[model samples]
Target: MRDFSCFSENGVQVADAASSSNASITTSSSKIGQNLVTCVYQCRLRNFSSFIITITWTKNLMGQGVSVQIDDSTNQCLCKVEIKPWLFTKRRGVKNVEVGSKLIDIHWDLASAKFGVSPEPLEGFYFAIVVNQDLILMLGDMVKDAKNKIDASGFAPNVVFVSKKEHIFGKKAYSTRGQFCGKGKVHDIMIECDLMGTNDPCLLIRIDGKTLMQVKHLRWKFRGNFTILVDGLPVEVYWDVHNWLFGKLMGEAIFLFQTCLSAEKMWASQSILEPSWSGSLHRDPHTQGLGFSLVLCAWKNE
Candidate 1:
């Protein structure tokens, strides 16, 4: 791993990694280095696979930056840039919620699957963790901080609504369940998923729900492939493309969209405004990057 403590000319730290797993990069301070603005350094591994570096630090401002680049296929070492945050003692009372609550209740499971089940109202929902602990903790902290802001602001901030749905493929049958928002106004959705638990990153999709479509792990910016469906049948059409980007820390992303590919055949060719959304946090901004945190919030459409 490369140490960018000195090379960051713009207060932005830059590090080059030869090859490392679960790489832990740290800064000299608790807050991101002064006037530090950092972005992911485009990188390439081998000749075909693109490598995006992930940085885990106390705050998103500095420390780690992840970037994806089209294959240059010639460079020996990849440069991953980051800015170091000011390292400070963690505030007290920052504790992990015990693993007492079920990660996903049966109701949520059914709903996420979009299976035909009775709607059981749930106050909140949780998705299993996929990313590193530091990232998760950072997400929890950011959500908590955002909640604190909501409570203190006194003015009613438009709550972003999120609903969970799932699709299942077994040896014999396939089915979907939950409050799916397929054809409606765009809403913010956070999905937690694993593609066969292989960690093979895949885009997530949903069909037959009240919520439109959602993408995961888009802490930066992204444009999605357009697909549509009708009664679980493809219409072979594409709609106006939607774009999702997060400049903030987004906890473990649910990037397993299996239905988006299947939905393209159902829609008529028409230009529609793509849904624009943003998140409040970035990759990981936990107290000390311990990476232990959970998120739950209420949602309301504007």
Candidate 2:
């Protein structure tokens, strides 16, 4: 195995080192047969304290479901609510949990939620998190219904999407969608690596069907990174495919799409590796001056 401790400066590390430090990544990656999409958002609660809300959507043999977790700036878990797999009576419900002295309410109605190939819902759903009677985070297209049901109205919650982590499986092509910046247009991201019956494998990455980066001599350069432009923003693309090139048959590859305007400055500083799997959600985005990050764990399907 390659020593990844030295690559901390560039925010890239070997899978073993990365997984050992991040419990979430280890947990998600171990579920090789399931599809998971975890989104992290930063928002200030009614008390003016910033908190991180992690929402994870899961799809497996049982069915599809969602889980919500709130953690304070100190990385202390305040509360968590999990909506079990779909069933007749579990389609819609509300859960109230007391965090410290504050009561947090989680409301969701996924009975009519529509899903695509991904576990995340596409429409016909409303997921709202209320704190101190104020709607702090809201998701889905049922905005009017959410507002009516919550019975709290003022201005929209000031939520900043911090990062996203998804687990995708494919034979030779892995694909997903991502929004590089806030309120930016979503684009299709496709990663293709054909290693079957060939002496050499090449890596091709495309955005919106347009090739952005291509690497030859895959065996010699299987683990590296490059800079790309998306929506006029500087994005640092990193990949670690050591497992794919040399590890077990079911080994997965990790790709990170990090958007940070100060990427140049960041590269200059001696910072530890903060790959998407490293759990960037624990850090405050505003204070860190970090942009959105998307981490895709691509598993090769046999």
Candidate 3:
């Protein structure tokens, strides 16, 4: 049984006065009694925008802790406050696991442009999944590089704390996880595409799949620019598609992603395998054109 009374602030957990680094808190869910709380040290990472956090409480507090990693867009401490009472008793020989959400809205800028190649936050780039409230996996840059064959995937501490059921209440551990797109219900499908590659120009088309297409006819219009339409209707698909396409061409990759309001969707993105550089003005010999792509994946309501 982890100790919930040892916390200081409303949700701030304070460890020993001598060890503030390990300070954590506990909060109760309206539906349940109390849930464990985890904190991300935002100040520690100088130029980062988000922090991933995880929590662990007793079975009475939901058995396993409700783990969800949230991005701090405002550059503040984003905490996951679970209001449920579920006791989590660890089985002597069984392994418990849980997969959380994805951080699919990360923006890439100059910091990642050095080699004409950009990289997601080495630590905060991936999604966090928890098991039985003890074991966890922070899959970020490691999985990516591993997938790319540039690095290895075997890393520890990537899997956080682990403990038995009866010993959870008064004990302390660390882990992280988050929710993306779904509000916790469950979404098994997501469009997975990379916005960082140069050789290949990928196209993502957005459409109203729910609606019927007449003759399957589409028009392409270029007014000092490129434009495309669906069912003879003007849309911003061109802009959205190009942004993702050229961003990858320019070497800025979209490691994270989201979608729009309508059901049907399409867009284009590129990627670069080598390091490159970009400048504002054209140089003497290499009249390099400054190319920029502005892709908007998440729907914006005006």
Candidate 4:
């Protein structure tokens, strides 16, 4: 009888945000919600079966909370659970769920977790999901603790980070960190573009401290994709800053850096996503790694 809220059982959970005095978090879906982070992972069961799991971690007036959703190949959700911010409750717990006649267990520990500017836990935390007694998907840095708590049976699940949808707030310059490959170093990603008064604006992307790519005359190229090298990996960067340059005062921009995939091919396959702000975070679940997709939905703070 855990205090978890079962938002969706074999379906979808509606994202609704309300105001509270909590003061830290601002929104619900991370799309409409401010100060939120959403991560999506594709994992296969030991039986060669696969599914998509979306985890949205949010902070708002009430507190910091997390919402998890599991969906099948057809995008039909299986089960979803929410861990709302609480006081006097265990920051770590376990959940037993049933989806499609399968028994799944979700374990989490974040008692000592430390966070930076983002709501997502940076370290000292773990979120593990077990299905059929196999470690299907696990996240966080406390691997030894995770292994000790769960039964490490069968083979490790073939998991791939399909995509991420993060809402980042900034004015002219927005920055974040990214690891292009599991073995590659995490580089500081900064996107600097000015849309103040100049008509001939430019989009500049920097890795760590070095400028990787710069697009001049951005007004004519506000919506396009390009490839740049970071840590010796070809990362395709897609950007849609239409609203930022033309629409609203504090409009948001969408940028994506998908490695090991051609921005041209991804651009051609508009059916999948088309690399636009309107497109939800999507990727081929069967996509093999060392490939990962990073989406930054940047909202300008006026």
Top candidate, metric TM-score: 2
Better of 1 and 4 by TM-score: 4
- Cα RMSD (Å) per model? 24.1, 8.8, 24.7, 12.9
- Model 2 per-residue lDDT tens digits across residues 1-302: 12222224443322221122212211222223437999899988666887789999998788788889898888788988788748345877788898777789888988899886689988999898888777789888998877777855454987888888898887788777667775777777778888888888888777766566776778877776666777776787767787788888978888878787665455446232333333432334445776787888888887
If both were scored by lDDT, which would come out higher, candidate 2 or candidate 3?
2
- For each candidate in turn, the TM-score is 0.18, 0.82, 0.18, 0.80
Worst 10-residue lDDT window, candidate 3? 215-224
3 or 4: which has the higher lDDT? 4
Error of model 3, residue 14, in angstroms: 19
Residue-wise C-alpha lDDT for candidate 4, range 184-226, written one tens digit per residue? 5656667777777887888877665555566667777777666
RMSD of 3: 24.7
Worst 10 residues of 1 by lDDT: 102-111
The Cα local distance difference test for each model comes to 0.23, 0.73, 0.23, 0.70
| Model 4 stretches with alpha carbons more than 4 Å out | 1-34, 85-88, 152-155, 271-277, 284-291
After superposing candidate 1 on the true structure, give the runs of residues whose Cα lies further than 4 Å from its correct spot: 1-176, 179-200, 206-221, 230-246, 251-302
